[model samples]
Target: MPAERQTETIDGHEVSLSKPDKVMYPDAGYTKADVVGYYRRIAPIILPHLRDRPVTRIRYPNGTGTRPFYEKNAPAGTPDWVRLATLSTPGSSKGRDTADFPVVEDTATLVWLANLAALELHTTQWMIGDDGETRRPDRLVADLDPGEHTGIEDCVEVALLLRERLASDGLTAYAKSSGKKGLHICCPISGEQSDGDVSAYAKALAKELEVERPELVTANMLKKERDGKIFIDWSQNNAAKTTVAPYSLRGLGVPTVSAPMTWDEVEAVRELRFTPDEVFERVDEGGDLWEPMLERGPKVPEVEAPKRRKRAARPRS
Candidate 1:
């Protein structure tokens, strides 16, 4: 018989977990308790990245293979210790009804979310600031998505190109496999820019890359035009937009993680992937290589936008 609930001590905080023995990864036979435990083990390192960021919980109540839905506003009956951030639309605090979002403060709250089957943690690049109402983004993400016929290798190629381009602009970025079929390259900033500004900047950079390497990259988001190229998804840097947090487990059949990687590791991804236990090991040995993501802001100098090029007219059939 399966257990109905569990009460575990995590970081000295007692977390009440329901459906502890419920199968959350059906094929792997891993239970909800197992995922909670994983989060508990990784809480120390992963917690910092999640600190202050409003999280969007992607829950799979039954199992990873079953139905899942996104929950941005934390559900009812949330504990007091688990902090919540409220932000109104257009990034204001005074003009409208506010929505309360959960902020992960410690391992106990993390365990609670995990127990709720919040397997994928999606957070904004920005945090609500100390003054209590600022939505300025501190990170920029360039999501390299491959087309139907393309693969991770293509994304890797484009990512390397982007890495070089960002370097020339005096900023450094960290790369991580999306734990599925994509790659997310991120740059930590000084938290001084609006979400709109960062979004526009990402779009401009993607457009610049598209113009330079038309055959390999495309800013066009439509599926038909991206059959064999990499699509630079820049829309994720917006105020309400959220990307998967590093160390979050993806519901991709196996317990795959959105693990961080070095440039060389990305180049040789075909050789191996960081598995669930493997990621824990990586943290145990190297600490968070992604720590640099919170280190400094971009040193980008202002540059004039590139002029649009006129494409040659197509001949009539």
Candidate 2:
């Protein structure tokens, strides 16, 4: 028989946790409660990134050994206190309507999602306003994907080069591992640039990187064209797109975390791939290294601003 369910009060809100004893990570024997505990510990740094953003959770009911499915809309039994954002995007593959995705603004909501075995917390780059309208991205991500037989080491070197290149161009870029094979170098896109503008700019930047290091980097998304090179994927900047949230636990062996890191840490691959325990301890020591990504409005150099509307509409709040 399954373990008994329990109700816990978090942030003055009641959240019912079911089957807390179910092992979500078999290798490490980490139960559903362990996942909740991890999220609770990392909520401070993670929740800020998720505030007002619609989340698409990757659920693994039978642990990492089994197949996982993407869930966009919050389940019907979501707590009344947990907020929801009705977005107009491509719904899930299962044909479920995701016009409403659960928003993780507080610890209670974060822990609630974790208990559902939502191992990968993928969130949109944009933020929602009071009227629930999602806007442009605050930062642009260059997902450095390495091709065939290559590893994180290649991505690390490319990330360092990209960092310097962006700095010389007058933009600040931050690096973090994808908790898998690649490194994601995020550049802060400030001012008021539309999603299309940011996406085009990122594509241009990727093309320039490809031009500079044809032997080591390729902007081609095709697998056939990219062999032993890092491809800078610029598509993650789309308004309808989402990427794995930093500090969220990935559904990998032993629960690897999509933790944030500095440029120096990127130089060291071992430090980049942080496990659950290491991530918790790292937070206990260094605080949140990626907090700069959330505190927007730093005037990114040469940002492409959208044109003034012809309709004389109200300005962005």
Candidate 3:
């Protein structure tokens, strides 16, 4: 029998969905149709974050329980209606110089991706300019990843400290769940600073936090160093890197979304993970919590590197 196929007109664009009944999330029993529907409903709010950014998708063609692969370039057979961006990715492990990445500018493109089982949509800190070139970073992110024996509560503690630290520099911070096991603190910038400048500021801030609370936070990227603390991953601000886009679904055991949070919720830190249905309800009740990051804001302030206390050398016997 021929594979079942269906077409839907979204935003005046017709998109085809294959295997709409195929289960993408085995644990949650969510099908390809469910994924496409979620993206269609979420497009109104998520488009801003994805509009001009080149998306990197993590595809699970065999369902979330099976192997997954990262797709940076627009896959073969991509619809011509889908917007494309030719980006220069220097030092890419794949050894490619330039890649044609997909830019999700509308609901149809998003639905297309969902049909491919692209559960996770990741984006860089920079945006594509009107000339189709990558621009300076307009936002900064600090990913609070928990280590062994640490959890969301630990990330919340670090996030609050980061909020205060960023406030001291005159920048407002927003909080969100990583949709997996971490928390993301983001702030909008004026789009005037280079990726290096923004990354330096983020690194400096993370280092400062590490110094302020050595036992609770670690700026070091080494997993061993994060045994009992939240690792402040400021490297995600690099131009070449991509963080999971807010409202994107994760390919975890269950269907969880990268949901934005209010400071009060962050403070409470009880329920950080949210399912797709719950996220839709959240949008109905609270609107977009990540909307504040869409506005133009101040530049990232230059931060002085905090001096680390030197470790005492052990005398050889």
Kindly give the stretch of ten consecutive residues in candidate 1 with the minimal lDDT sum: 88-97
**Quick one: ranking by TM-score, best first?**
3, 1, 2
What does the lDDT read for residue 282 in candidate 3?
95
Candidate 3 regions exceeding 4 Å error are: 1-3, 304-317
In model 2, what lDDT does residue 45 have? 82
| Whole-structure CA lDDT of model 1 | 0.84
Question: lDDT of all predictions, in order shown?
Answer: 0.84, 0.82, 0.91
True-structure RMSD for candidate 3? 4.7
Candidate 2 residue spans exceeding 4 A from truth: 1-3, 90-98, 297-317
Measured by lDDT, the strongest candidate is 3
| TM-score versus the correct structure, for each prediction | 0.90, 0.90, 0.93
How many clashing pairs per prediction, in order? 0, 0, 0
Residue-wise lDDT of candidate 3 within 1-317, one digit each (tens)? 54699788887888888998889899988988899889989999999999899999999998999999999988899988999999887887789998999999998999999999999999988889877665688899999999999877888889999999999888999999999888999999889988888889999888888998999999999988999999999999888899999999999878999999999999987777899999999999999999989987899887555589999999999
- Give lDDT tens digits, candidate 2, residues 1-317: 76578889999998888898888988989889899888998888898889888899999988987999888877988989999988666654666444689999999999889888999999877788667764777888889888996677778878888888778767788877788777788876673767887787778778888898888888888998778888889899888788999998888857888878877777766545678888878788999888888866444445555587688767998
Error of 1 at 41 (Å): 0.5
Question: By summed lDDT, which 10 consecutive residues of candidate 3 come out lowest?
Answer: 297-306
Residue pairs clashing in model 2 are none
lDDT digits (tens) for residues 1-317 of candidate 1: 86687687766767788988888887788888789889989998889999898888899988888889888776888877778887664553334466788999799999999988999999888886886578888888988888878877788889999999888877788998788888999998878777777777788889999999888899888989898899999999888788999999988666788899988888877732466798998888889989998775863444455689999999999
